[model samples]
Target chain A: MSWLIDPFADFVFMQRALLGCIAISLGATPVGVFLLLRRMSLTGDAMAHAILPGAAVGYLVAGLNLGAMTIGGVVAGLIVAVLTGAVARFTALREDASLAAFYLISLALGVLLVSLKGSNVDLMHVLFGTVLALDDAALTLLCAITTFTLVALAMVFRPLVLECADPRFLASVSRWSGPVHFLFLGLVVLNLVAGFQALGTLMAVGIMILPAAAARFWANSIGGMLAVAATVVAVSSVAGLLASFHAGLPSGPAIILAAGTLYLLSLAFGPSGSLAARYWPRAHLEA
Target chain B: MALRIRDLTLGYDRHPAVHHLDLDLAPGSLTAVVGPNGAGKSTLLKGLTGELAPLEGCIDRGVARLAYLPQLSEVDRSFPIAVGAFVAMGLWHRVGAFGRVGGQDAARVAEALAAVGLTGFDKRPISALSGGQVQRVMFARLLLQDADLILLDEPFTALDIKTAADLLAVVQRWHGQGRTVLAVLHDIEAVRRHFPETLLLAREKVAHGATDTVLTAENLFRARQMSEAFDDTANVCVRPATRGAA
Candidate 1:
């Protein structure tokens, strides 16, 4: 208890890191749940990778200026997203294949751009993130991104669900499908940019997708999955931060690894569809 | 409100699936579209619902609100949503994306579920339902839509007899409420039994009139023949001159 209490209480940096993680978890996890529901978990990962080249370009231009990097990342991400969608729509290639092509190219471009100007240490920081060294500016950006995500998500909640569940029905009823989908993509890119500040471009999607995949085992409804995913992310953030502090490990991987462990646990023991529940079945309900 | 479709051509990639179609659906008319597998019964509905833009013509629906039920395959049933919440989506026109679901809305949802024989099953996840139950849930959603015009594509194709009959009753109730209903169906007998008007199509309209007249053997055969005669590599159509054309 003291190990958990003392670090957060005494160290201001630790407090900021924790707050940053919690804020990201609140915003990104719900988006992650929808991503999972839409079967776009890998799309989140692809988009995360897609953010790198823009971020790297920002690094090349302005070094460590937060605004420069954030804008660059967002622009690059939206470009990839739009291009991938267009390729899928206009060509014979499907969305997943197009996405894979774009993300791979984006990743290679990012690595090349980073190496062109910065040393290996700066490159490592960009790839793996510097969670422990979050300044007031970085923290404020994360909070702002989270606030926008929550409000936008609230606004698009019903139509978003309908778009995922029954797109044709939604199209028939309202003309909001295209706008809602693009808005959701914008949210995904924005959250990834925020997570990139805390977890790096490479591991940014880890905090999103892992907890969402884990929540699928524990909950049976969209709202329930969202609640469970947010909880998992929050808990994993605390555990990972504490572990990284104690073991002198890199913070981003530690947080992601914590989320990975929770996913495995949920897969094995969660009440809804876990391996344990499957093997040791409950009695049938009396209808 | 009446719907007038003039020279509608709908398809994928500019290759028309439904071609040179002209139709007039009377207000409160209960109509069934019957044809072979590739006869574009679904395409016409897609055109009407605005899911597919017409390649050649227009549908004038006159500001009527529409509720469309695509084939079950179009819906992602694996999505994690409660039966009640899924059904409540019908109130989208009223509640919209941000509007709250009030107490009366909840009661309306319950009534819809009850109408579809899904009483007290509100909390069940849609993933847990069988094919018949899923169809019922879709019907419940339609009940809540409360639209002036309804379109159903293959609504009873895979449903069990009981489920089909129950759903048919719901469709009839919509007719009783003086709403225009158009359904794409395979069971000619069911269409004859329930729907008063029939439009026999095979990528092109074969006949459009009262069910008994339009569903005759000659019309049905012509529709099948026209469907079978479709050319996969055919170029864009050159329509023959109409009677009044110069």
Candidate 2:
């Protein structure tokens, strides 16, 4: 217990890091739930990598200011989402093909922009995050994004879930399917951008999606799945933060590693259709 | 309580699947649209429910709320949702875009499950259910919508006989309550016995009126020929008169 509490007392930066982790995870996990359910986890991945160009451009124009960079990231993310959707809907191109094409283009553009600006190190910090250097402003921005995302998610939870489940039915009942889809996708984009500091583009979606997928291993209902996911994300973020602080490792990658561990444990030991289920004496009966 | 359609034309892209068709859906009646494959039976219902845009006509009494159920095959039911949560989607349009579901939503969902004879199965995951059970789940969803205009497309194509009868019984109850139901069916006997009104289509309105008038030999043969022309495997709809008939 003393060792656990030591990090909190010895370093102000550690406390800030922990708080930042909480904020990023909170904003991301619910969005992750919808993403996994809608089979848009891949889209989340593409968008996360897709934000590189926008953030690079923002850094070139305005340095590492939080507000300016977030706007730039969101604009770029939305553009990728819209373009991918249009290619799929209007043309013969498949969704995966469009996503891949857009992802590579945006990534190359980001690389080109970063080269032009001569900030390769800064670009690394932006991509992988520099959570050890987190300050009060970064914490505040994280908190604000988490709160806004949570509030918006709470309001549109039902429709979003339904739309993911059966869009045709939504179309039959209401004329607002298009708006609902865009709103849900927009929230996802916002949360991913907000989470970039703590989890990085490569691992942010993993933190967002894997824990929720793990939660589904235990819960049978939507409400239960959501609650379980929130708990998992909260626990993993704290665990990851503590581990990083003790070992003097990067917090973002450490947090994602912790999340990945939880996913494995859920897969191994969860009751219904898990790895443990296979080894039970009466497992054959379940089948 | 009449759903009137005037010069309703429907299609995908710029091409027309249904053209210049007029229909009056009677209140408190079960109307079945039966025809050959590609005969626009499903397309017609899609136009009415506003899922597919109409190229030409207008729907009278357009303000009425609508509910729709597609064929069991049409939906990807492998999604991880519970029987109760599935039914609760009916209230989605009612909840408003930014609203949270509360006690009222729960009550309506419970009521829908009970109405469809799935009272105790509310918490069961949808993936655990049989095909027939999924169809009932959809009916439960329709009950929660409480929309005056209900449209179903080939809802009984894959269910067992007992399950199909049970679901049709639910539809009969809805009809008795003075709600409008438009169901697409391939089984003519079920249509004749369950629905009083019938619309026969072969890329157009081949026959539209009471079941007895439209279920004649000539119309059935014409519908069959069209079915063969379009897709040979499409079920040929023929209504069997009661065993006590001439």
Candidate 3:
């Protein structure tokens, strides 16, 4: 308990890191649950990589300026998301295939840009992130993004769920399907941008998707899944930060690894639909 | 008329899935759209609901609230939503994105569930339901929609007999309330028995009149032959300048 409690209490950086993680968990996990429900988990992963080039460009232009990097990341991500959707809709290529093509290009371009302008350490920071070193600007940005995400998600909650459940029906009744879908993609990109500050572009989606995938085993409804996912994310963040402080591990990967471990555990033992649950069946419902 | 269309040509990529259709739906008409598999029955419904834009003509729906039920396959059965919440989405037009589901609304959802014979199924997840139960849930949703015009596409394709009968009774109830209803159906016997008007289509309007007259063997055979003769690689339609002059 002392080991777990002392570092965050003593170190300001550790406290900031914890706060950042909590902010991210509050916002990103709900979006992750929707992505999981829409079967767009890989799309989330792709959009994460898609933001790399934008952040790299930002770094190239302003040298780690938070505002520059955030704006650049968001613009780049929106461009990629919109372009991928347009290509899928207009051309014969499927969405996944087009997304794969765009994300691969974006990843290569980001790596090349980062390596061309900065040292190896700088490149690593941009890719894997420096969660423990989050400053005032990054912390404020994280909190603000989380605040906006929560509000926007609430505003669009009903339509977003309807769009996911029955898109054609929503389209027939109201003209909200297209706008709601784009708004959701915007939220995904916004959360990824927020995650990128603390987790890096490469690992940002890990926090968003891993806990959501794990939550599926524990909960049977969307609301339940969201709750379980947010809880998992919060726990993983604390555990990862503590591990990073005690051992010599990188914080972002440490956090993501914690989430991964929980995911595997849930896969095997969660009561809702896990392997253990299947092996030791509960009694059937009276209905 | 509740709805009118003139020279409607709806399609994907301009290939004209439903070609050159002219139609008028009266304020309280209960009509069935029947044809062979490729006769554009679903496409016509899509055109009416504005899901597919017409290529060469227009649909004029004059101030009518519309409710459309697509095929069961269109609904994401695996979505993690409860039956009650799913059915309550029908009130979207009234409640909108941020509106609360008031106590009265909850009662309406309960009544809808009871109407569909799923009275205590409010808390059940949609993924746990059978195909027939899911159809019943969709019907309950339509009941809550309370639209002036209702369109159902293949509402009973794979449903069990009892579920189909129950849903058909719901349709009859809507008709009795003087709401206009149009359904795309493959079952000619059901259409003939329940629907007063029929439209036989084969990428074109082969006939539109009384169910007994339009569903004759000759018209159905013509619809089938027209559908079979459709040119997959055909160019964009070249209708004459004037309707009768063609």
Runs of candidate 3 with Cα error greater than 4 angstroms are B232-246
Local error of candidate 2 at A219, Å?
1.7
- Alpha-carbon shift of residue A26 in model 1 (angstroms): 1.5
Instruction: Tell me the lDDT of candidate 3.
Output: 0.89
Those runs of model 2 whose alpha carbons end farther than 4 Å from true positions after fitting are A89-95, A279-287, B13-15, B61-63, B72-76, B92-94, B97-108, B227-246
Q: Between which residue pairs do clashes occur in model 2?
A: none
Report the C-alpha lDDT of model 2 over A152-172, residue by residue, as the tens digit: 888776667768778877666
CA displacement after TM-score superposition, residue B81 of candidate 2 (Å): 3.3
| DockQ comparisons of all candidates to the true complex | 0.80, 0.41, 0.79
Ten-residue region with minimum lDDT total, candidate 1 chain A = A167-176
Residue range with the least summed lDDT across 10 consecutive positions in model 2 chain B: B237-246
Highest DockQ, which number?
Answer: 1
Assess candidate 3 and give its TM-score to the true structure: 0.95
Candidate 1 falls in which docking quality class? medium
Better of 1 and 2 by TM-score: 1
lDDT of 1 by residue, B83-148 (tens): 999899999899888899999999999999999999988999888999899999999999999989
Predicted candidate 1 versus true structure: per-residue lDDT over A1-287, tens digit per residue: 89989999999999999999999889999999999889999999899999999999999999987889999999999999888888987999998999899999998999899989979999888888889999999999999999999999988899999999988778777888888988898899999999999899889999989999999999888888988998899889999999999999899999999999999999999998899899998898997
lDDT of 1 at A166: 88
The full ranking of all candidates by lDDT, starting with the best, is 1, 3, 2
